[model samples]
Target: MTTITTNPFPVNHPLTFHRVAQPSPPTPFNSANSKHNTHPLTAYTYSTKHAEPKLSATSHEDQPLLFLLRQRKTEEAWLTYSQSTRLPGSTCLSRLVCQLSYQNTKEGFTRAQTIIQRLRDERQLHRLDANSLGLLAVSAVKAGHTLYATSIIKSMLRSGYLPHVKAWSAVVSRLAASGDDGPTEALRLFNSVIRRVRRVADPAIAADARPDTAAYNAVLNACANLGNTGKFLQLFDEMPEFDVKPDVLTYNIMIKLCARADRKDLLVFVLDRILDEGIDPCMTTFHSLLAAYVGFGDLETAEKMVQAMREGRRDLCRILKDSNWENSENADEVFVKLLPRSKISSDHDPPLLPKEYAPDSRIYTTLMKGYMKEGRVSDVVQMLEAMRHQRDSTSHPDHVTYTTVVSTLVKAGSMDRARQVLAEMARVGVPANRITYNILLKGYCQQLQLEKAKELVREMADDASIEPDVVSYNILIDGCILIDDSAGALAYFNEMRTRGIAPSKVSYTTLMKAFALTGQPKLAHKVFDEMLKDPRVKVDLVAWNMLVEGYSRLGLVEEAKKIIQNMKENDFYPDVATYGSLANGIALARKPGEALLLWNEVKERCGQKKVEDSSSSAPPLKPDEGLLDTLADICVRAAFFKKALEIVACMEENGIPPNKTKFTKIYVEMHSRMFTSKHASKARQDRRMERKRAAEAFKFWLGLPNSYYGSEWRLEPDDGDDYSTDSF
Candidate 1:
């Protein structure tokens, strides 16, 4: 075993724990006890097989095993019992072993055999004894390797050992599972066990319950499983008379027989008996219920059960994982079929509807939904094409499926491909749903193709077969708004209400966004009112962000605060969006202290715990990363240089570089503004500017224009007396 010492241990399973350091003899532990342990559960040690680093001599740390084994108290006892002693261990390993043995419950007794193989690899092969060997034989027999199982059994006999009656019960039970119920050969095996037990001495004979009775039950079940209804009935009739008290497994098999036979009447009959006997139906039982509901078209119930299985609400890892097919419409149904009906349930009847049971349609729709959710139009189309080839027997996909793909493509902003997919769907006789039409409408609206979008809308409305929902109307309204046609959006919103379709948050937000875009806050506020009036309308993050951003940009600080306060009242906590506005708006209003406070809050909320331990503080609000740079320029406009400098300092402290082109332009403007505001004489300023331009003039005089050189005025200069140095 690898030692468990050191900071990092490299091992797959950490259950093999050991100690790290040396100490005085192990003692009892208490809060006030000596400092000997690092953690209660943590163990560290070195490999016994290899030389390792020694523990530090200074620290007094005890090994965990010493304490666990009670070294000081039980040292002599352990030495006395050394040869016969079993090392103490946690029960965790025992539980793990039991769990490993139950890997395959339904497929036969192969579980024990599989564990033996693992044990053999782990060099623990000696763990296999008469009982385990018997289980291995049972697994082989049920796996249809009867010859191998026989060989194993013979080997047991040769070793002067055989499984007890209990082990014999397991072997006989597995043999009976192989459908070899031709005669009472199984009865002979049971009788053989009786005779052998009688021959054993009384002390050895008095072990666990007689394994012969277990063999009896196995034999009886074999008869039932073989479809010998007459024989099964005979056994059932004789079971009570034979004094065989049916165990849980025996009745479970009976329940299974009913479900497998698809004899619904017998199924229900067996269900009542199970309940009368007060037997609990596990996940396998509920799986059988799901199967029964499959042919009945109660998909909702089936889906509900499936959800329960998926969510781990039931102990179904053994039940569903082994039985249910992955990604199949009838996967849940198969699980149900394995189960027998139940009078009692683990959960209340859930209102889940399993979608259409058509495996092909269900799979196709599911993939399409996933693609739509991910905005992967291309993948959606590819999956649809494959489904079309399988089901339609044509070159292209069905219209409905194709339409779904096309609609998803449009939503994903793949307009060209969406149109292509649309053509293909139309070719395949798949009519589009409202969502499909909406995708095309939104795409056209974005491209400002009003005529095409309107045409499709009209087509949808004219068809009584197609019901236009809120999304359909919203798409058209959004298209209008995108093209700066707020009038069109307003008309569509009204048209939807008139048509008895309620406006969604999207409907209101689209109009609000349009108003904000046009710098019409009043109009936006009106839409906000309309949204508030509808109890069902809940504004999304995008809507609130738009209002906050728009109000901030206009420097309406008080109104922006009110919006934030309202959002808080509505229990909508401010995110980065609201904070950015708070920082920029306050900065723009020349309230640098307030701006600084808001900045601190943003950091405290977003970066307090983070930046304290962080390698660097918040990044300076980059023009690209944030819009607060506008507030920095506004500071220059408001003539608050000190406050603007403070903002720069904060940005720098946060590692933000304030390299503002706008601020530079404003600086130049500010200089000009200051001079002009002072009413400084232009000529007086001109004299100072003339002195500054002397060097530039000297360079210009040497590099005179070619045209000027050709000019007579430049070639023949006036008298030096007339052209003074100042004139030159």
Candidate 2:
């Protein structure tokens, strides 16, 4: 047996504590100390600092009362006892632990944290024993206060008190699992603990300080959360050096990381190593691998992996039976009783076999999600059927199962089939959720069937009792806009507001777009103004772009420019669409010079201009194909042939293909100018003579002797016709 070292602080330390000095507030200084002061200056200095309160010795009579309160496990009464008897800090700390222990409610947890902070502020934190602090740490983890938990552990460790393994694991795991700033903080704490453990000279102290597998796994989790694949792999390799062998969770974390990094080779290598080392792969292990294969489009391998999982489930049942768990109907029924709710839906529902199985609904749901990703409707259908038919598996279809199926079908453009799946869900006692209904609504709207979408919304309210949320109305408005039903969109928008459902940013943007396309530019502006006035709605670039596009479409060049300037004033740079819209508007209005200026500004903004261009100092914007095409068309219309050709070259340099029709139009126009030029007359006459000779030759070949060979084929004397200016 491993003998634990003696604790520096006993679990039942005396409540007596010496009061520490608390810093006082700053005092107001007087001018009397200044050497430059005039002759007779009397000044008084008021010091806010007060003397430290003396410590009170422990009362022997109060100890019995504190013990009685602790014995009865009455935390509230302990609080009253501490106040009445002036018990030691140890009693206060014990009361705090008790408060945190029974804190199952959210409000109770909040009160516990408040008490912990209050004790720290009062300089009573030193009275906490290692065990009491450990309990506090665990409570912090349970309450999701990872930072508080880490702070508690760090304070105890700094005081040379080593926390138990469970405490360390709880704090580390909470920090690692937190997806926010927790991962970064978790790494910092892990490093601190590791360094402290390494610095300790005593072997016994070091043993208590050294992190175990759980602590290491927490760090691994942090690395995984941050997607630091390189760091994760490095630490994974170093686990053996730390005398912490990889457990099932270690492999599971590695597999998940590998899946995210798309390191298929590494994932396979780890799984194979697990098998070689006789480490049984848990459900998470297989789930991670299966998700990876499905994500990478290796559906065949994923299907086989699912089959292997099923076999593993059967093997688990056999092992359990051989272990005498299945000796009688009621022998050791823990396994069957502890089956996940996902496996067996209701309490009254019986397990499929004499015992529970491992390949429950989650595995099937995971596979269904993979199929959804691959868009394999047929395979998803087959899997659903397999779940329904599996005799020994109580984990047949659930709500998640039906929802995944419905969403997949909707994405595949199968609305009718999706509705049928929803009906099937209802038949299987799995009611359709908001997500399921929303998917169907989106499907209908995507097909431009707004009437069907409206009917679906009505059905949701009338039959399903699910209110049409902001998202539902947003989709409906967008659907109306798709088929140019502006009035319909507005009606829905008004109805949404009347129904007390606030329009989201998407709602406003979609409505703006609808108004813009219908030539209601002013209405679009009104919509934007309303969004700005509403405190809940913060207008984004998409909203501004839609309004700008509306004005530009109506040849409101100045209005569009003002919108861009306003956007700049708001610290938002104009994107390619904004710049392109303005440029096209200016060009169409026949302001070539202004259009060229706008294009140069656009090039500078998009980082397309040479460094020599004066306006290249602004932050870069992303240039899209539409912007380039607009500039090229503007140049073509302006008859800046040389500049037009330069624009084409710029387009080629930027890998933006020139618009063929627009380029050909410019090319023909350039040649027309050349045809009318004095130097090209001789070349043009030669081309005309070549065509005439070829026509005569073709006539001779056809044996039409009465053609150009006769006197009727006289060349009309250079009489200027419509082609005179164009001809040589």
Candidate 3:
């Protein structure tokens, strides 16, 4: 007998077997060996070499890590991973990183960064392949870590790894949509990708890394949003060089750029360019055109454009073209002539939209908003009804359209009708979102219906499943201010924070206004300090103005001035509202010299040749009638006639006609009897004479008779002797 030596299992293992060879030739069962053969040990033999036992890929070493990750026990999972003798497989490690990134928490992002850094330190970053890094970038973006996502993409590029288009494109798109230097960063990332493509030696890698049409669209959108017309043109010109073509979306973005730049004259030419490029116009194309017209407050042209769409007119461009550009005799001809030939073509061709674009709900709502802007309440309501009657489902009024109707009604003080519209929204099975509820809240608050506003808040939570956001709270706070309920404003402010709704800049400012209006300047200051400490809310000029108003309302002129000085040191120039509040404070405090100083500062700011002039370091201030009148009233009360005359002249220059009748009343009530008493000294007589001459000049401007005086008798010089104070 022979024994087989090969065995797949190790020695001493449970599955290990030791067996003698079977009989070489056929043999009958014998009783002597039957006992040994009873166990039926079948011998298995290998033809070549011994084979190793096959185990599951994820069953053994990665099981613990996978289990912890699956249970979301990331901390425990990392601990197990760190104590491991060897690193996990690339797929396992990549999954760990992805799971960490997907957590979307600060700790999760920090942990993910730590893992990547560990890999780099250990020279094991190669475990994470291109796909893995690309996924990480996308995950970071979803977590709101856009800058971190951008860094991940840059790392991929540096490693000669071409990330998926979705990864980099998403990063660029998110960055562009973000505020501040986001758009600039988006452009820089796009350029980096482009440069990376150029440096790649392999055609396959270059093609993979090359910015696609979507990437170009994203960066172009950034350019448009940044209002970089020159850069927009430059990037657009570069598209064709990279074998990328502008699609309908590209033209739509260009239309937005035109609107933002206020080059309304170029809007039609953009549509012409779209048709020229043979790109079929989408609904967004028409919407952009209509929105551009509406935003520029050219409702007449906007209505005409909408009418053209309703009539299915093919000559949309002709119907909506700027007449100022067509008429060569127009005064703006020189301005139009200076536009770039590419952006605005002088050729008056018959530019027509190739296809008809029927107006949708958005288009109708945009038109309604324009009507709302002009306070044309009836027109906005008619537009809403028109949307409802349309046969197309796309034209049916949705939540936004209904909201516009509500807004129009609210603006017209038709609160009862606005409430009915909300009911209509529910009847039509259209869900009113938080914005719709907030609008109603604001209207109720403005109307001083605090009870109704509070009821609406409850209804939002119970019936609509809509919780009050910061705006809702802000409106309620402002309503409290309107009703002089500072306590109620404080209650709403505190409730919003308790409900996990962080206070915004508007919220803080509105609350401050409540305290300020109620003569609680100290409380307003407390709120201002809290706003400064809040990292989520940015303290803007409005907030600063609110702080000043708070102190000014209490006649705290010194405190208000200190706040204004701080406002300036922070690079925020006092606007009309700021100065107006300060003027009120000065008037309340009865400080004439402070009013004089304020007038001087205001004149300096208002005296600039142009508000947009580059040489001016501070924004030009255009004093409103309220501010001017307040200062003038203060001057008249203090008998500063010369300063008051200068203020009135400024008012006339700015097209704000001075209230001569009101100023005359103030002069008669306060300063009419001034200099009537006899002066003892020659110097006092000369000073009084100087005041009398200035008062007479002011009187001349007011069209008052030279002989007019208050109830007291007039003081006249006797026979051209100026020093004589003779009462007539």
Candidate 4:
């Protein structure tokens, strides 16, 4: 076996100890002497090479050294027996005392062992060894006393037993999990254990027992949490040395670690490895994959994964059914179709199964969540039907699951399905949550049913006494703004404050979008300033994008510029969208210098090497003929002649040609931004011009003449055109 060295005492945890002396030597045992061989001949041996015990360099060696290596503080225990003048109990009693003492007070580890010796005579315990040491270690580690845990582990080995990978694993796992301390030492301990387990070759027990591989797997899981992917990968390759088989847990751990590290290549690689290893990955494995795809909003991949899950669920159902059908009386465990036979035919009340399989509650709830992710309204109804069909073994369906399905359907634009989910929840006598009411209210708002949304909001507090969260208020305010009811939006906003529910980032974002859409910069800025009091809300890229799009739509370039400064001050740097917003907003506002500064900063942050040139902005000169062309298009539609003329002159001075569609569009739009009266009655004028013949064709290919209509709308094509790059 490899020479052991590391001390187990946790010096880092403030109350933990520091050893001042070398641990006492192990009790001497003459393993080679014929008369001294007191153990059953059937006791596990290191080698079967010789008829008599021929010292195995690995599992067993000279008894004194093995004893010494495993020894903890037995010298104190041995002395306490002599000093007390009372009979020390049997070895069994001694160990029981040690266990109880360690469990109660870890600060007195030496005293605990002394009590064990004083009580030893009654228990009559045998000498401890590897197998027992590993089991005791599992308990000790669980209790969070590392020193006592390590001592007992070594104590077993001191009685002429070498620790197997199990004890080593127990100690390593405990040390790693006690996170206030570092992981490096625990990892080092694991490596030494692996080497020691390897060097000690078992004749047959190693094959059936599988101490090395199982221990290695547990350590791998611990290692995966540390973000040390390189070391983890290396360990993966080295796992075969001890003939340990890789299991599903091993692959799952590696897959999750890769996802956390953002190593997509390795994640897919390990996924394939899971298939090759012939281990079926669990839901947890798929959850990690699903979350990873969703994190960056990789919509295509997320959709594909959802599709795969839907298809695979059918296969899983077939497999589960097949497994159940295959089970016979001779089978070690009866694998029913996830339900026991008694439950199927029970006229009387039956024993309830686990929460996961219990009808009408947790199980159906989980299935509903899966359906919502896949946008499977049909499947959701089927699962709810299944829940209703099955008699609930114990508790009834709770409101949490009922409302979750409702909210999901509402968000997916399936108002009928949302109402159906809510109705089923009510039929089951499940209480409606604030979430359920909020979801339906938001849905009504989305459908432009503002009065109904307002009525529900009032009912929530007055009739139901359910306090609404920020989402409930935001949705109503948004709906009000959508229907040109700014007064309603403002009233809802005030009510949100009065209710003592702090507005979230979503609340601020929704209000800002409403203001930007209505060209109310001052109101939007007021809400944004209020949001600053809450640190939870950060000015993210989407927030800046909204401002850019909003200001651009209204031709308020100065307002957009101020928003950019605020975004940067909050430490939110510009992305590709930031540049697009600036370029579009500045062109509308007729500010080339401001747009140029934004474009330059975008280049610097993204590095010109990575980001390709976007056609939205021109280098050196900010607002070019193309920009004027865009502005003129907006002007012609809005019927703002003065803004159109200003744009044309700006392009002309910059030596750029004003395009035909843009100029004609702008001239027509000048008639619109002032349609109601000869004054700046812009709304009616722009609406009439927008319906014109020639203006329609030019704006179709690009977004609107002003604001970006879609998220990530680009003038240039994206490089991720090949869907295959992500799938494999």
Candidate 5:
């Protein structure tokens, strides 16, 4: 018998087992024990051949949280950390934060916020290093929590931690894209962050946090959007200080700024500057240039620019220089200084564009919009056809191009053609978005085609699968007003809310307009009140004017005056529309005294300038023909000839000719026999003479013969003895 002294099985083998051989009997095991005793008689022997229970690889406490995170088991990982007594490592926590933020869901963001709050409470926020904080911030921005991302970066800055350029740039870009005061906030945030970076002691951290080209572009874009030309120039100049060279996008943003500032002369110079800087222009540069020209109502210039692109002529600077741009001489001095020196002073100059730019769908669409603006419907249609025939797919008409065609047709009162275009869109497989449908709906509403508008709305939902948004309901409400159906307007407004679509400012204002048009002033007031209560909508000037119109239409002059007072209190001055409505109200109420007062205020607001003097500066209040006419009508009806003459003079000064024919007709019908009585007392004659002189002057201005000797008159005795005058 061989006695194996050492254990035959490996200690760490899975199947290894240890057991003591049962001592059968002292006499039976004597020889075996004696043989094993030579190697120091073993108390136990191990064997791998026998089956044994498997041991766990690791304990629960030893499990890695990051492993769960890698499996995307975020919730489980978090739960495990919460249940454990020891906190996870900093790397694990940072990964958890980043993963939660990247989920991009509302719940995900909320949970991320909760995690941050827990860290702050535990004084463990420092565990998340600067790099991890930056990732979290960028992730938050991607998840649509821009403000939250901004807060995160701000917290980092406050804690003497500098964020990466990507983190702050993303936030700035998002803020610049928002409406209202978002651009201003973006500028403020950029200034603060940049200040912090400049003050950093460590060169490495400063370099990482320093605003790069993208960061500068973002803040410059914000400045452009705000129309702060001075701020834009300041920031643009600062780019060189930061050692950041301006790219093509920087010039693109500069073009937009010039457009907003109405400095068309600077546009070409900007292109020249781009070329001088050795930067290639992008497609957006061309589109922005065309759009700028179109916005200025300079379709001639816009068309020329597009033609230059089509003909592969890059001498845009030379072309624009030779052409007569209206606002060229009036360019802002500061802006002009920033542009590169113009080389196209003489007609012969090199092309600014380095390469031939082919007109794409967007470029074509921009030119089409210019044609649409000028009411060149045929040109717009021809352009659309031209786009369809283009071999290059980039130049082919897309949905926006088609939508422009539809808008042009609608504006031309060609609803039939517009609807046909919609069909063509479907046939061509270019799906019409809500904007296209809304344009059609607005056209129908403007034409008072309520039934057609309603049908179109249903078609949008049932066929196009495009739900009618708030704009659709707003259009429907205005259409209802056109058909004198205030109840219909209210129903549509309610339906919009019931469908969970929030009411926009247009919706509220439009519904208020419905009530105002139907002579329901009180109901209009209620609508206005509801609008004030709606946080989603702000009461704009149009809404206030509608309220004023509601009251004034019913001859509620006092109430209208009160509303105007409220309008002033709300920082909304009385515009021409407001005064026009009030004037109509005054006419209805027959309050000539109020007319005189309103004229005084209007004259002051208009600066009482003559048409010849209007070239110097724009009047604070541009005179409206309708408002002046309404005021003049009131004065003539009340036989206030002096006040009527004043209003007519103001009209002529504003270049709105007085309605001499209407005034002549009024005089013949109402005041032909005025002051023709004889035998009046001295005092009474003196009192009547002033009005008589004013009437004669007005008749003279109207090119009418003097009433004193123009025609034969029969006199009768006056009934009232106070004046003792004969009536004619």
Candidate 6:
């Protein structure tokens, strides 16, 4: 153990410098007799042999005085505590308190103890005020010393020196708002204070120590921050027990928590209590109420709340006028009487209350959202007009309002109207965001307007300075598939990857679907293989089902079967779609026996069978339309008329009445092939001839002979030339 000190004095110098390290042994810094020992062991020390040469002349006599300038640490307080008896260390104590107030806890508390000892020596310990102690406690908390802070507060309270409510509130607020263990610590401190307050015999001292509304509100806000509704309600109910009254903020907090939890009943109960107490609801109260009603989609109730808010504001204004309080400065007392605990400032004049309850843009936006949900387009337009006529700039329609309007119109398939809304958004200086443009993209895609969708993508990049995202590329790919433009879909897919936007599962699925529809099963499988090789994409059951359906569509039943087996091996279950695809493929392959076996399996799994009794009523297994139609056609083709009758019976039993026109056409085709149609009705024969003519016209449009099957349309070379970049 090497002894070291900044003061280069030998250990024999007793009063000259006291920080000499004893060669005996090291002990905990706390165990050192700080009072008698004089020099407390500090963290940083140096051996004499290793001490810097410049520090040789540094005198040990001024060590205590030199520590006063030490910027960091509690050394100055300790030095002042040990020496300098004539001079009061009030400034040093204040500086130490400031440094310790919510900073390094271990060091702060230690320094605070030294300051307390010095104050004790001066006989001024009891003279410390509530504000000074409260600040000390708060500072301790900032240093993550909650227990120490709690002890300070508890000591003050027990001594009958009730800390200022603001101090208690600040400490509670900080403790309760901390990440994990804060609320627990705050609760413990609160319980201790409450216990102490109740035990106080003197009413004046008890009142002084008792927490006020603000302190309670701070703790309540902590509960609200966590969204713990149960804890919030329990704490709220305890307020009256403590003789504390719930103010406007209390009710506001309760309302917000109830809205977030979607507890409409609790909200109503709280609102009723507020009304019974004659509490004037503030703007936040109405805002929360409106949000709850709108979320519930009870537009009528939401509208009523808006009306009530207007009436309430008007009533408040009438009371102000009837009281003859012209200016807010003179009206502060009057307003407080009318609205208890109301915060009114004397510095600035407030805006006059509106003569009528004119709803602001936020309210209108909320109402418009409700209308849009109910598909009330006309009502949304009317609200937009109302928003534009607002008397205050704060009530002006904002970007969110316009974005919502554009989205609603797009969903309603009013592309032209949606475009007009977009134009109006730009005119109002509300730039269209990616979502706004994406909505328009969807609208055009629904109409198979690919050219317009492409134009929007280009405009988003070039004009709006917004790069197209994965969703934009996904939409473009989907739009191409909708119009059977496989080449366009491929080009968009490649462009997305080239632009460093990885293709999503939806992108891959769309490409596969396009290939399947174009009589290209091989290309669809190739796409599936590529998707599996990419680690970034998580392959889902839908992707597997797409692959199975592609093979099934090509009349490759064995290949589809293999795909299903592979799905099970990979821990992916085959759903209704998998079985349906396999059955369709087998039936189309002219393997009636295999199709029958698969249908039986489907019936068993669905817990359904042929209805033995015509009148026996219970709903049948609800198969999707695609599966039902395919099975029905297969039965009709196999000439299993009884099975076809069974299909019809189940269809009717399940409330899914078969399409008579479709069944009739299948029946007629089977009949015409088996025999001459001499007995057919004239209308039926004429319809059959009309279908033949339509098929011929379709063949002509494809530029194929009557029996030709292979037809592929390639894109013009110049189509993608302009959009090529480094991504190519």
Q: Which candidate order results from sorting by lDDT in descending order?
A: 5, 3, 2, 6, 4, 1
lDDT of 2 by residue, 1-728 (tens): 11112222233442222222211111111123634321111111123364424545435754654565546544554455546634355544454454454444555555555555555556465554455566667776786556667766776665555565567667888888765467778878777767666665554544544567877888988887777766676666666755888788887787666666645534554554455457776767766766776677766666665665576543322222222221223322222221222122223222112222257776788878888887889988888888888765546878778888888888999888888998888787778878778888989999988788888888888887988888888888889999998999999999999988778889999999999998888999999999997654568888889988888888888898889889988977888778877776776576677767776776566554445555544566667777777776665555444455556666777788767665555434432232232344676777655434433443343243324656433223233332322211
lDDT tens digits, residue span 103-125, model 6: 44666555665565555455555
For candidate 2, the lDDT comes to: 0.64
- Local error of candidate 5 at 155, Å? 9.9
Kindly give the stretch of ten consecutive residues in candidate 4 with the minimal lDDT sum: 14-23
- Candidates 5 and 6 compared: the better one by lDDT is 5
Clashing pairs in 5: none
What is candidate 5's CA lDDT for residue 117?
A: 65
- What local lDDT does model 5 show for residue 697? 80
Q: Write the per-residue lDDT of candidate 4 for residues 376-400, one digit (tens) a residue.
A: 7676666655555545443234676
Q: All candidates' TM-scores?
A: 0.38, 0.54, 0.74, 0.42, 0.75, 0.47
Cα RMSD, each candidate: 29.4, 17.4, 16.3, 19.3, 18.6, 21.2
* Model 2 TM-score, all chains together: 0.54
- Comparing 1 and 2 by lDDT, which wins? 2
Worst 10-residue stretch by lDDT in candidate 1?
1-10
Any runs in candidate 6 off by more than 4 Å, and if so which? 1-298, 305-363, 391-395, 412-414, 579-583, 608-621, 660-728
Q: Between prediction 2 and prediction 3, which has the larger TM-score?
A: 3
lDDT: which candidate is best?
Answer: 5
What does candidate 3 score in Cα RMSD to the true structure? Answer: 16.3
| Candidate 3 TM-score versus the reference | 0.74
Q: Write the per-residue lDDT of candidate 3 for residues 16-107, one digit (tens) a residue.
A: 22221221211111124433332111122232365433332554787788778667676787788878867776556765765666555667
Candidate 3: list runs displaced more than 4 Å: 1-95, 100-231, 238-244, 297-300, 322-325, 328-347, 374-386, 610-616, 687-692, 705-728
The residue-level lDDT of candidate 4 at 38 comes to 30
